[model samples]
Target chain A: MVVAEVSIVPIGEGPSVSKYVKKAIEVFKKYNLKVEPHAMGTVLEGDLEEILEAFKEAHREVLKDSKRVLSTLKIDERTDKENTIERKLRAIGIE
Target chain B: MVVAEVSIVPIGEGPSVSKYVKKAIEVFKKYNLKVEPHAMGTVLEGDLEEILEAFKEAHREVLKDSKRVLSTLKIDERTDKENTIERKLRAIGIE
Candidate 1:
């Protein structure tokens, strides 16, 4: 499994962007991937290709309403063991 | 031009991972991309392809020294106008 954190920003969209973020979240949900939203970005867990596909879908979804879209993706894939958001946090003693 | 914020973490490397981060930053610098290190990640400004290439290089550099690497990239690209880190923060009144 891979964990990806993604942030999509629509330029010139004024200050509020929660609506765009919500749209991206909906895309992730539709993909049936585990999603966790945080202050900076949203974390997703799924197969590597599925996560990338979801990221692209979310980016495209957000871009539809805005003139310019800027998106970021962070991927964490492990071959040694199963990795998840909760496990990552707990590893650092966050929970 | 584009602005990318990247964070690479080497899994199972305990709590301190600054050394790994430093390696990534060096790759960005070597690529001659403008880089700004932040609390959460590093912001880079350069051509989109260059930025992506540097990201890959950084990821590989860090991966060489660790077992598993997890990296995150956030890109802000604009075709309407030039985009930079300062302008982004200033747009939101951060000065």
Candidate 2:
């Protein structure tokens, strides 16, 4: 599983960006993806397969109107590394 | 410890916002705070004690120029909720 945080900036096409965002949400729904939509970007959660496909389609559609898009991506993999620490501590036989 | 994602928008006072951001960073540093600075806002990670103070100061500085400050905040507790499920499953005798 992976999370993709994507931001789409519009140049001469603010409305285009809005429309693209709405369309992207609809498409992600088709794939049963989790979406956290923001004013300027979206935070989506799903498996790599679903995320990659949906993101690609979303990117492509927005890029279709090149004169109106500036896309930025922020990716953060939310994982708890604490488990590794706990395992190591347990290996040392410490509670 | 808590992570606070704060967005500071400037009204007629964007430069004041920029200045406030810089000053705010300095103030946070004075108290040893972690900051993630973005174009539109900042993401600060610290204990509740540290974050609230810096944020309040930051908020005050920006609001000083009432004709030029708009502030927005977003908070997310980035904890792995999956762990609870994993532990429950383990107790139920599943991997």
Candidate 3:
């Protein structure tokens, strides 16, 4: 799963994040994306392609609002299972 | 009381907003500023001048973190008693 981090800056909302966040929740639900929220942002988890598409769609909405848009902190991540990159030698029958 | 809205962008933090926002809470406390969180942002309330000073202080910290800085949507507001701007015609002795 991929995690898409986002930061929205309202075009003219004057920093009323509560309104924008609530709308974001709706977008997530509409697109069936999984989100893990921490503070004023959300970590979206879904298929890579789908997640990116959703991100684009979300940003489009932000632009439409003309009251808000995504800011700098917005980012994306893909999960690769913890410690999977470091395999055990015994598991590989090596050493 | 005035409300100062703020947004942060971590310079090299790669968009890990959760971490930065948590730290921001500490900074807010350190400055003795009153914050009312509305989502991924905060609404600061205090004396008009004090509130603005606090905003400058907060932004300075963001820059110091070197991980993130303020973005658009940050705004400030000073409260005025409701209807005070438009005194009642009866009270003003004018129809």
Candidate 4:
């Protein structure tokens, strides 16, 4: 599995962007991926392809409202080990 | 409070970057911030200034071993409402 952290910013959108972010979160839900929404971005865990697909969909969704959108993504994939957001936190003694 | 999700990639580093990421995580801990380590990067919640300071320190720490480093940060700050990673998840119907 590959874990992706994605932040989509809709530029030119006024001060608050909760509405756009909420829509992106809905896209994640539609993909049936395990999502953990943080204040800045959302963490998604799933197969690499699925995660990428979801990101594309989310980008499209956000673009519907804003003329310009900036999406940043960081993907972590380990072939030797299986990792998840929860497992990573546990490994670092977070919980 | 502001939440920042940062991912620091040490360019030219071989396939595995766990060592560098581990060092960065230590920097976040040293700053006494609540950190959640994910597969791709780490989520830190703290005052804006403190978070930026930690990122600076982590960048320096990562640079000790890596000749080149790329750090990406997304900050979400809302003056009208208090927000947090956990709270965001809860608002999205995730616990």
By TM-score, who's the top model here?
Answer: 4
TM-score of 1: 0.62
- In terms of DockQ, the best-performing candidate is 1
lDDT of 1 at A78: 67
Where in model 3 is the C-alpha error above 4 Å?
Answer: A1-24, A35-51, A58-73, A76-95, B1-23, B31-51, B61-73, B76-95
What docking class should model 1 receive? acceptable
Which residue segments of model 4 deviate by more than 4 Å? A65-68, A77-95
- Considering the two chains of model 3, state its CAPRI-style docking category: incorrect
True contacts kept of 2: 0.00
Candidate 4 clashes between residue pairs 3 or more apart in a chain or in different chains: none
Tens-place lDDT digits, model 2, residues A18-85? 45566556666677566755433466666767777777777677677656666665443435432222
Residue B9 Cα positional deviation in candidate 4, in Å, after optimal superposition: 2.3
lDDT of 2 by residue, B1-95 (tens): 45455655556742223455566556566665566454334556556677777777776776775556555555433254322223322432335
Candidate 1 chain B: worst 10 consecutive residues by lDDT?
B73-82
Q: Mind listing the fnat for each candidate?
A: 0.69, 0.00, 0.00, 0.38
TM-scores for candidates 1 onward, in order: 0.62, 0.40, 0.41, 0.76
